[model samples]
Structure formats: C-alpha cells, structure tokens
Target: MRQLLQDLFDKRVNQFVSDKRSKKLFFPKAETKQACLANRSAEIVKVKAAGKIIEESVEDEFQTIKYQAHYQYLIKQNGILYMEEEMEDRLAKFYKNALVMDEEIRPILESENDPETELNHLDLEDHTERLSYAYDRLKAVQYAERWWNSYNPAYKKFQNDCTNFISQCLKAGGAPMRGYPKRDAGWWLQSNNWSYSWAVAHSLRLYLSNSKIGLRAKEVSSPDLLKLGDVICYDFEGDGRFNHNTLVTGKDANGMPLVNAHTYNSRMRYWAYEDSSAYTPNIKYKFYSIIDE
Candidate 1:
C-alpha cells in the first residue's frame, strides 16, 4: 500500500511539473488545473504532494483505504511566483497486494432551493433605518486565515458550509446581522437557527443584491473590482442557483483576487475557481463589495 501511494504521488507531481493534464480516466481535477493555469498565463514551476492514509479496512482479500492527498503548486504568473495549495480526499482498493480502484471523493453542496413564501413576509420598511457601522477588513481577513480549514464551534456547521463560512467572515468584519428568527428574511444566525441568507449561497446572493439596510453590498461588474474582504458567489452550473461562496483575502500579481473558502477548504487560492471540480463552461459569478457606512 505504501509503495502504491508513493508511485501515485510521484505521478501527480510529474503531471503538474510537465504542465500536462492527467490522462487518468478519473482525473478531472488535473485537467481543470492545467486549463486554469493556461487561462491565467500561469505555469507550474514546481510541485509537491503529501499523502496520508486516514482509514483502512480489509475484507475477503481486498483492502480499502481512504486517504488525503495534499498538494502544493509553485505557480509562476506574470513573472511572480505564488504557492497555491489544496487537499483531496481519495479512496483506493487493493486486491492481493495489487492496486485496483482509485478515485476522488467529491463533496456535494447542499440542495439549492428558496422559500418564496418567507421572502414575501419580510418587512420592506426595515430599510428605512440605514444603521451605520465600521467594517474591519483586517479582522475579517484574519478570521478567514485562522479558520479556512476548520469549523468554528460557536456557529452551527452546515453540510454545505461555504456560505456559512463566508457569513462568519462578514460578521467578523462587523457586518451587522438582522431579520433573525426568520429563515428567509435577513442575514443572521441565532440560537441554532439561521437565516437562509446566512447559510445559503443563492439566498445570500439575493440579499447582497437587494438589501438596503444592515449588511448590504453593491454588485460589482467584474471580479477585478473586488477588494480584500469582499465576497464572490458562484453558480457553477449557471442555472441561476448559486452553490458556493468565497471571501477575498489577497490579490495576485495582476491585482486579481485570491480568496479563502470552506467546504472545500482553501486559502490564498485564485478566485476564478476554473480549477474547481464543480466548474463548468457556463459557470456564472457575482462579485460583491461589502457596504460599510
């Protein structure tokens, strides 16, 4: 098992260093990485992989192993070098000490749907009070850096945690939360209950677009318009239902955003997400600049 994993890790590093997309039947991630690198005028100058077997079981001469493969890519773009990292959960099966099956375990985002009835109940007059507050961008980015790969025990962790994680970052920045006790009305989380906008990507996208009071944002025309501590929402299928959200933590050499996210926990990653397994040719994005007043 050790030798098999070593060989596989070697191949993974070679694939990135050569800038050739993996031809392995189940390797869509490698293909996506190469495609994204090309789109960004980036190349992998070096690559490294570290693997750990997290679980192992055996039955009837067959051994099944669940492992994590963490990769670090030294990418060069516009004459600057940036290190991007990601981790993958993978499963492998071996029979009679020979490798048989190997595949990535992809995460499923929670279902995408809205409660229209709840939206209708929201008080439109709520916006008449434009409560002013200061946004602490530095603290927000600090929180993102501290918890990108881990869950905060103070909040309820969701199966699809991207939006919930982004909400935490916004709250850390002093974005006021209101319309609590109503799941669809505003952006808030309290006592085991959370507004849809606080935990759902699609709902948060709508709230940022339409809200005029607390925790409001302005939709930007492009990703480049986003600043540190801003938010980006993704509709990977481009079918109008958003499924993922990220918080900007840094900028690349070309001034494009580098973001941090949970669910598929990542940090300082290129914002485009062209390399995401969920990415599609029709992927749509909404860039939002958090309003601070």
Candidate 2:
C-alpha cells in the first residue's frame, strides 16, 4: 500500500513538471511591446524634428526658432527617458512576483473564530512585512554597482539616467505608473503646442487626486506655497509661449524654491532661480502644488 501511494505521488510530480515545461515551450513570456512601440514612435518623431531643423536655411529667422529647436530636442530626450523608466518598472515587477501571496490573507482574518485562527492576523502582518522586505531587496538589486556597470551606452544618457533613478524611488515607495501622463520636449516645441503652465497644471491635478497625495488644485498658488515635489512652469515670453518646467526639490535658506529640470543647456540639477541659466526673460511663472495624501 505504501509503495502504491509513493508511485502515485511520483506520477503527479512528473505530470506537473511536464505541464510546466510544455507551457514554457509553447508560450514564451510576453514582451514589453507597448513600451517598445511607444519608444519607436518617439524616435521617429525625433528624427522628423531633426530633419525639419536641418531643412530650415532661411537667413532671416524668427527669434523663437532656436527656442523651438531646443524644446524639440528636449522632447526627444524625454521620450528616451520614458522608455528607460518602463524598463526599470518591468525589472521591479519581475522581482516583486516572487514575494506576492498566492492566497488572500484578509479572508482568513475576517472568517476566523478560534483563538488560533484569530492569531492568523499575524500572518497578514507578516505578508506586509515580507512585501516591504521584497521591495527593498529588489531596489538594492536594481541599483547595485554591477547593474549600473551593465547599462548600455544608449541607456547611459543623462535624461534616461535621471528618470531611471526617479522610477526606482517611486516603485520602492509602492507607487504604480498608471496615472501620470507621458510627455516629452517635442510636445512643447510644436507651433500650437500646449502651454507649459497648462501641462503642469493638468499633470498636477491628475497626480494629486490619482496618487492619493491629498493636495488639490484649488490650494495651489505662487506666494502661499511651493512644496517639495511641486511643479513650476514658465511662459518664456510675455506673449504666452509657455515652454519650460522644473520640479521643486526644496527651498533655500531664504525660503525661495529650488528646482530640478532638463532644458537646452541645463541638464538635470537642483537650481534656485538666482543661480539658474534657464530663467526666462520678461516672463511670469506659474506654480502648481502636489499634495501627498
């Protein structure tokens, strides 16, 4: 009888292994096609913009053309940054897959009657602890020196590097990438492009509510605020060419806003207006607050 039972278990195990192998052979893992397509499209857009800039040989040109080209380059770089961010997110998800529970811990808690079952709440707590541990472990792995050494030259560009770093922080904090709209420097360079102030305003509106970050649009203002993570946008000329953006990292000793941004000559760095070369002439800036719920 014991021999029969052992044979039965062996059969089951063999069948499970066969099924797993078959699945792997028949259906390979899904590629990140959506992200790849977006990246490719962005590249095409960049090439077209570059072509247009090259074709323009008129000796007498508007002052704004230089600004337009600068913004176009910015958008192209932003597209690359977005793609890098998606790659990091995919890596984080791969690591997280191993730590997620196979069963619901909540149902066990709600249905529990016996003392031992009630103590199962500890199991739920343990799940949360495990998730945090997994997140930390994944982040460490993702950011290790070995991983940095493995980055290809294309991925080593400044915008991509900064966005990848930021993506790691967001993932570690348990934030998903669903709500924020994807944007690039190209979006700002078009002739009838959306205003920088409007883009920041709308993005802030979506982020505050969607991110559960407690801040609201009605609360945003220039003098009354500007918190860490708040967004500031510039209308480069008083004629309403809203063309620049920066995120508030912190305040200076004198209570002025310090920002991080990418632009024509300025890559990524924290800057106060007094120290920034990207400061616009004859322009009024708009400030949008990000409320953390």
RMSD of each: 2.7, 26.7
Which ranges in model 1 have alpha carbons more than 4 Å from their true place? 19-28, 111-125
- Model 2 sits at a Cα RMSD from the real structure of 26.7
Say which candidate scores most in lDDT: 1
Q: What lDDT, from 0 to 1, does candidate 1 have?
A: 0.82
Residues 1-293, model 2: lDDT tens digits:
22322332343234322333243321111122222223434221221111111121123321111111111111223334211110110100111112111111111101111122111111111111111112232342233212332333323223223223223322333333321122311111122232111233222222332332212222355623765545555554444533445554444343445444432222222232332222445765666553333
Residue 45, model 2: Cα distance from true site in angstroms: 45
